[model samples]
Target: MATEHGVHAAHGSAAIANHAHPLDPLSAPEVERAAALCRQRHPSEQLRFVTIALEEPAKAAVAAFRAGGPIERRAAVVAIDRADGRVFEGRVDLAAGAVEAWTHRPGVQPYPILEEFADADRVIRADARWQAALRRRGVTDLDRVQIDPWPAGNFGDPAEEGRRILRGIAYARDADDANGYARPIEGVVAVVDLNAREVIRVVDEGAAPVPAADARYDAAAQPRLRDDLRPLEIAQPEGPSFVIEGHRVRWQRWRMRVSLHPREGLVLHEVAYEDRGRVRPIAHRMGLSEMVVPYGDPSPGQYFKNAFDSGELGLGRSTNALTRGCDCLGEIAYLDGVVAGGDGAARVLPNAICIHEEDFNILWKHTRAAGQTEVRRSRRLVVSSWATVGNYDYGFYWYFYEDASIECEVRLTGIIQPMAVGDGPIPPTAHRVARNVAGPIHQHFFCMRVDADVDGGGNTVYEVDTHPLPPGPDNPHHNAFAPALTPIRSEAESARTVNAATGRHWRIVNPSRLNAVGEPVAYALLPGETVAMMAGEEAAVARRATFARRQLWVTQHAPDELYPAGTYPSMSKGGDGLPAFTAANRPLEDRDIVLWYVIGVNHIVRPEDFPITSVHRAGFALKPWGFFDANPALDVAPPAAACDCPPGECVHGHDGHEGHAHGAAR
Candidate 1:
């Protein structure tokens, strides 16, 4: 890379050296003397130097001189040198003069002026012999005669070429920054004729000006370029399942079904049993003891016997449940095109089911319809026996058990999107904090609150607070475990305490608090319910229940039509039709949902979580399920077919040569 200054140096040195003669091998005095003499003799000329080899040294030299003003006469001569260093100088002989004279001819002149020709007649006459010579050699254009002249042996061309050369020189000179002119000289000349709407041509005298019509020419304008600007179109699948109606569903202990309607929309329906029922179904009669179990001691199959014969269990409402027990079984049968089949037959399978039990508190209530008590009780006991059947295979399982819920006893379990380590924490200094966290974080003197809604609709709610504890390994099951757990505090005590981690004092406040670790908790309150149980190791406690709820919904109620075949991995098949693999059933819409989540920086850092730190939250919304009819690209109509004739051929006829000749002339 040459620097700007380096370029300037190279150009300047070359130009000077090309115009000057070297004085001495190495002598200041000799160099100065030669420079002085050259300048004195040709004050307006810049001298250049070049070395030439000689056959022998000679004492003969010639001195050339011109007598004219600055605008016209210029001449040159050479002096010969001898081995003795003696110089012989005189007027150049005839041979030299002939060479010089030839160099001075019209075409050979270094600076020929076309306007100086008295008329075009003089030019035509002077070039007549040359033109004839060219014609004899089969050359036709009189404007293209070539000639060479002088010791320089430079070539010259006809008058038109000379004019074009001069025009190019003028353009270059005008464009040169050193000259500092505003626009090309030729362009300025054209501007003078702008009002006349005609092109101005420079011509020698005695030549008639070419008519504008004769000189007119046309140029094809390039086609206007266009950009393909279009919004991206997302293809949606067709079918009832692809619509919003496909997303609603219902669930029960061992069966799940969609509430279908002719037009209104789909609804959820589920069934469960209580211990007070009078009649029960035999496990063997229902064929409930054949299912496999995946894990856990005592096995779900062992409990099926007890649950089938004894009316000791109760049924409760659960937000999360799978419909595999009924819907899945139906779907398999439908695929096989069977209405019903014998027991143990491949087509006769139970609905896909996932079951789990939680302790209930005395505050809970259980009620059942009574008219057909025998049938209902029989169905419950019979189905309960199948809780362990097919349990080990991992499709779906049912549970029949009993227990009591303790106050503040929060059972955290639900369907949650798969997560990985080092994936959840919000980085500090994010531009937008509130929109990212699952919910807002609330800060106070001694505690921080985390609040997140299940979805934008607030159907489910999650909230938790920070407590102080010794730093240790985090619990793997629930993401709640942080190295340090902040100690829990009463509202009054929290207001008075200063956060040790952040070295900030806290003050009592209602909903809003300063130095809060997480955003203030907020969730949709179910109708008639005031508060939900909150418990877990700090972080785990807040998200576990919500995750569990989401799981239940996905397993039991998600619409089959919306998530038809090929949409997700299969979970079961062989004996009964069902996909064998379960997928993370999370749905995000056209735009991802944002969650604002915050947790304590450390167990002791209360004020640090203040102002709420944010982490991004995203979920997918259900979309239509199907394939596009055709490839989006290349489906466009082909451009109108083009004619085969060459451009201008049709309009100009077979003598298309005429159009080309005219175009070339321009």
Candidate 2:
């Protein structure tokens, strides 16, 4: 991030068509040049590719004084030598226009995890082995069948042996609803080793048959509408409330740069909100670090289905090109993302990033003792991206508010994963999402990495709790309460939980930088849509993602400790990421720190989830505490009342906050 006007600007090199800043992605030409180098190295031997992404360069100290470390130009390319199945990592310098460094990641297949899904899907369509399993069910119209390969993760299995494998299921689809898995052709499973490019195991119970898709319970189809029930269109002039300048977006006083990452979906960096005439730093960088979706029911077919969404498979790599009016509204700006294809070529996911402003209904309001009123309608700058992982679709959105707070949210929608529970009552372990389609109960865990450079990098964790004061001489009534603010002095003490009952919250404060009242400039961790991972430490699912164990883990800053769940968790055994990082119990107080905040959903499927379900959001906000002198947005006056009601009449009503406990972690 380049510093201008005492504010750190959003980082990005604007080399593409309509991009604003350089969240630092490799240009198509740069990636192509790197791929040519890999091909030149492989020459005659067949090579399988993994990832070719921007290897961030180290930043200089003067500019990166707050967020410290590398922010230079470099690219990383990973590929597998198929002749011996060896994976190689290549680093290229954009300035030199050539490969500057190379290394071999021994025993690990570069593109083993995700590419297998596509390979498995292709084999089922082209090969005869999976075709035979389909023939047994009397389905000859193979064109109508959709073979979707799911991530069959290795659960400490010794048999994996560094090979790319995928488990596939077939679904009968007549049209593309983005919910192809809704119409499940049950009682069939295909185990494919992508390295071998063959279906190794075919599970056909024969007891259960493929459910009929007679269009009666089509999940994607909308109900027939007559010449009635037409709604009025809502429009806002002034084009949009936000403006995109390079990779950066400026909405009111909130300014943040958006990055298109290969692993992390939508990364927001150089985040700072303007308060009055001065600018203050909120978060230097933030995004989803790692995620795990662990299924509850563990049978022969379901046990191996836990997905390390970010680690095993790349979320940004699978991002879908968003529709204009459907995905975003008003005047919009789109940023295309480039990812390494299966052949190590730079593939474009068009309209991969969407930047726009959303009307959140209200910002803030107040009433006077006299017949007077004041209110402000809220609008937010939204940076979003969508990714489809097998049966589920996740839309990652980062909302920047005028109040100087940033909300990181994940919207979960898409077809539910249908099971072979033919014509029976809803199973105890699962809930029926569609007709005869039992969607297994599961949990989606997401850890957001927030680098809060409150005033600078020297930050401390402060836990504030409301405690009942002892009924002594001072407290005549037993109802007296005292709020205690405890600054966590160690890393081990920072592994805390979100206590919903009490007014419990955590704050990342730069103790050295104090506000006018002599308090540290800080941002409060206001809990958002919340759910903890249910899998215990003993479970294989826990072994896959140790970060999901706690809701919050604060670790002293180390450049190498980037991922919470270790990198290469596809066929990994265990003990690499968060648990291993925290085991040393490193010093944490008043140091540069990274806060891993976990938020999720215990997705107990309901019938409403069918037919391309509604968005289930889980997130939290980094609210300004003493970072602002007052309500930073207070200076900006609200828009005039547009309704017919009298001023201060209906205005007394809440600004849409009823049961919404702004402080509740739940």
Candidate 3:
């Protein structure tokens, strides 16, 4: 795979042409060279690299490069001084072989690396106090204990102040590969100082018996299996519909560039639709900027359980190596992702992103009164990736339809965060999944960043809501209604929520570009299945992730304003990302703006969600409103019959009915 992508690891031996695109993710060679340059700057000190990835070029520079100009490659490096626990942020100019900038950011801690996590596990298990706690619960098999390192969130605890801490959750496993979450060792929490590389404290309140249900979800655990299911195959004999060169993809009327980020797993750049022989821009950049998974239980061990997956753990670093038939299907193309490990070394995650085409049933259809029918099948190009963040797995899929509509779907399926409970009445904060296994209530909030470049950059956003007119002369029959378009003029005003009663949707229109009817060319953003953050404003998570409270937030474009929950959310205090960005309430009229849309999923644990949870989906869609003069898929040709078995010889009719023709006598 490295050979296929020309990603050599000789450290600066590979030319920059191997990563030519301005927005391309850092390759293996580039990551090595960048790390080497950082090491050269601090030759004597030991540095623990947290994140190393492409320092995306400015918007103007990327646009210029797309217009056949040159680009300077750079990498952003975040590391911590192991000796002093000081955080340092640096930028390396790979083109010039120099360290462009290095600054120490005080009052903050970078995300813990994999190496620290592994070391913490060793540090905890070896601790005499932790071993005593396990023995108190009648578990003496040290090898069977699983120490899961979690971010020690800032809760104003004096002992945790100014310390790089990891709160460990203990689980008992039957074997090496068995599901550890099923048997959570309650009333025990291990606090480890990562810099000290030792267990700082071990709290054992009261031990509860671990659940002993048959939680093994693999096929080997099942005694019986379904044998009646038949095989179904997806074949695109001619090949995939999309063409890819470098990291850019072109499918039907869609054109976009794809990149994998250490923080944002899948990023789509310069997303545009080709219309009337001209490629027009829709969004300059699109990605999941931040996500917060906050458990609702207020228990001592569960209250501080909120996790900022992207900012704290990094989605790209946790991305799974997708399988062919399982993760994707039908003439698939895979992209390898390169991310920095704890030592600043390049770690290539093969098949991190999957690209394929899906049959969406139908695009458009019409049946005439004369018994003639015309229909066109719908096919969409899907760009997706999955990440296993601790107990849960998340799949991010971006779909590009031939009709010029875009959709982003997130699928959640994995082991629920389990807790051990006694045979008393279950707590309101949790549901009993097994005999003594309880799953806590939690919410997953995802913030999507869309840098709107709707026809061009000079765009305005309007909240369109359907309102029925008052019963009067204007509505004689009391049935007249119209869409009330409200312009989001200022940053403060742009912070809005979804009003399902009004059928609310936001429209991004380029005021400078007019459609055929002399209206602004626009696209509408339709949200889906959103639930508000149940945490109050005083809650640490609500203050830190203010963007989750509202479904939509519009801010004037700023190069540094990328993440919704600020740069470092590992142990952040609060009020940094959207709240800080929109504090000034800048005017957004006819300006280059970005929309931060939050998609929330409220998970109330169900009995069926146990063993292994099925996929729960939530997403949003972007449809061309006034951007297209008419139906963009009108020119799509109808699908041809697969087999040439003459009319009566085939088992199915042209309309896919068994042993029958359309409009035939029964």
Q: Where in model 2 is the C-alpha error above 4 Å?
A: 1-23, 41-45, 59-71, 109-118, 125-132, 137-140, 173-179, 205-207, 214-223, 226-236, 424-426, 640-666
lDDT string, candidate 2, 1-666, tens digits = 222222222222343434422245676666777777767766635675677777754323325633653434567777776566667788877666667776778855333534556667777787676677777766787877888766666654455556666777787765554346656666577877777787777776533455565433343354863567676454654356566555666778876677678777778777887766566666777888888888886655566667878877788888999897878876566777777776767777778888777778878866684546677878777888999887688989888777777788889987666675666664587776555667778889988898767766689988888889899898988889987888877777867788877778898988888888888888899877677778777887787687787788899877667788776676666677888888888888888888999987898888787655788888988888888677777765545324434444544334554433332313
| Tens-digit per-residue lDDT, 1-666, candidate 1 | 122222111111232233221210111222233323333443332122111111111101101111221111112221211111111111112212221211111221111111211223233324444344334433343332211100101012232222212111011121122211111111111101111212223221111111111110113222454468876432212211110111111112122222211010111122211113311110100101111111111211111111100001101100113353342321111100000110101121122122222222222222344221111011110111111110000111122212100010011111110001122453231111122211112111001111111211221111222444445465444445322213112111111222334332111111221122443212111111011112222322122112211111111112221111111101111111012112333332211111211111111112222222122111111110111122212221211123233344323222433334423433
- lDDT (tens digit, per residue) of candidate 3 on 515-551: 8899999999999999999988889888888889999
lDDT at residue 590 of model 2 (Cα atoms): 86
Candidate 1, after superposition: displacement of residue 368 in Å?
31
Between candidates 1 and 2, which one is better according to lDDT? 2
Cα TM-score of candidate 2: 0.88
Candidate 2 overall Cα lDDT vs. reference? Answer: 0.72
Decoy 3 TM-score against native: 0.94
Scored by lDDT, the top model is 3
Which candidate's TM-score is highest?
Answer: 3
As a TM-score, model 1 comes out at 0.15
Off by over 4 Å in 3: 1-19, 643-666
Give lDDT per model, in order: 0.18, 0.72, 0.86
